[model samples]
Target: MRSYAGQPRPRPLPARYSRQELPKDHLVEAVLVTIFCCMLTGAMALIYSHETRAAIRRGDIDRAFSASRKAYFLILFSLLFGMFVSITWVICVLATLYAQRGP
Candidate 1:
């Protein structure tokens, strides 16, 4: 075994224990997925609000009521999507941090 200065040199990994590397596109994939989810949520909310307003203006009580329900549901879905994205981001950040620290 060779030594580096006063310390022993680090040993190379054995063939049987070689690590499996992730693809370079993994980060891009993660970011795109997050953005897509957010955009979908925003689109749903916007459509719901616009339709609800139109229904109200047209004096269609039944349509307005249904639109109101849809608006609330869209808002709820957006909130849930936001929470999911945040949680996923946090987990990814933590995983990266831990991975960088090595075993």
Candidate 2:
């Protein structure tokens, strides 16, 4: 066995779990969206991300996958909603300015 000078490698997961790729938890994205986007949807995404991490810890593959999917969708929805609102606000502001200019 070869040893590196850096931190030691983590112990291998059980054969059952290690055999296949794990789903993403999306915890970071959830947190970011919660901070910078729609709070309600972002909060929901954060919850789903927590659930995904928990299920992953328990080695419940199906549950983990489901929670990960939910988290991803929530994050996406929050980003889209935020973008929609931002664009709408900008358009309204520009329209107001144009109206005030009395062209």
Candidate 3:
């Protein structure tokens, strides 16, 4: 319909038109895995996770993906290294015990 001056009014916007969609940057997983496994690699993963979120906010999809991948790899590496250290420690302890057995 037209106004009193005979000018047609603009169409109304949809109720949900102003919503923004943000990316999920696996920050929690990074921190948790790092805290329980390897602090050094875990810190690296946390940094990358934060970078992923920032890249998403900046509308850089490629950068966000790269950062996410880095975080994932860091977490994986931390877990692997943690396992390696644990296994080595167990082996050393066993060897020490055997040596002390008077064999």
Candidate 4:
């Protein structure tokens, strides 16, 4: 365990990859998408979130960050698509109601 006099000093790692900090998993957003938005995308988001968590556990920050980004975009897309569908349904329903009222 003695250090050799001829060995070079090891450089420190960057702060971002430190064990104290981890990439975002967006698990909460994934769950919210599952509960309130499209099931398909929500399920996909959940998968990505799980992957992110697993990568972080395995000490693979790059994979974790990639999975986290995927999950985030999936949640965003699911929420937007859900809102569009809901708004379109509401508009159609109101149009039908107004037509039936004949004024």
**Which order, best to worst by lDDT?**
4, 2, 3, 1
Worst 10 residues of 2 by lDDT: 7-16
Q: Is candidate 3 or candidate 4 better by TM-score?
A: 4
Which is the leading candidate under TM-score?
Answer: 2
Model 3 TM-score relative to the real fold: 0.71
TM-score of each model, in listed order = 0.57, 0.82, 0.71, 0.81
Clashing pairs in 2: none
Error of 3 at 67 (Å): 0.3
Q: Which stretches of candidate 4 lie over 4 Å from their true place?
A: 1-16, 19-21
Residue by residue across 3-103, what tens digits does model 4's lDDT show? 77993444344566775666788999999988898999999999999999887766667888899999999999999999999999999999999999995
Residue 48 displacement (Å), model 3: 0.2
List the candidates ranked by TM-score, beginning with the highest.
Answer: 2, 4, 3, 1
Q: lDDT by residue for model 1 over 1-103, one digit each (tens)?
A: 9766883443443344323421111223233433555667456555655665565445444564575566566556666777897899999999999999998
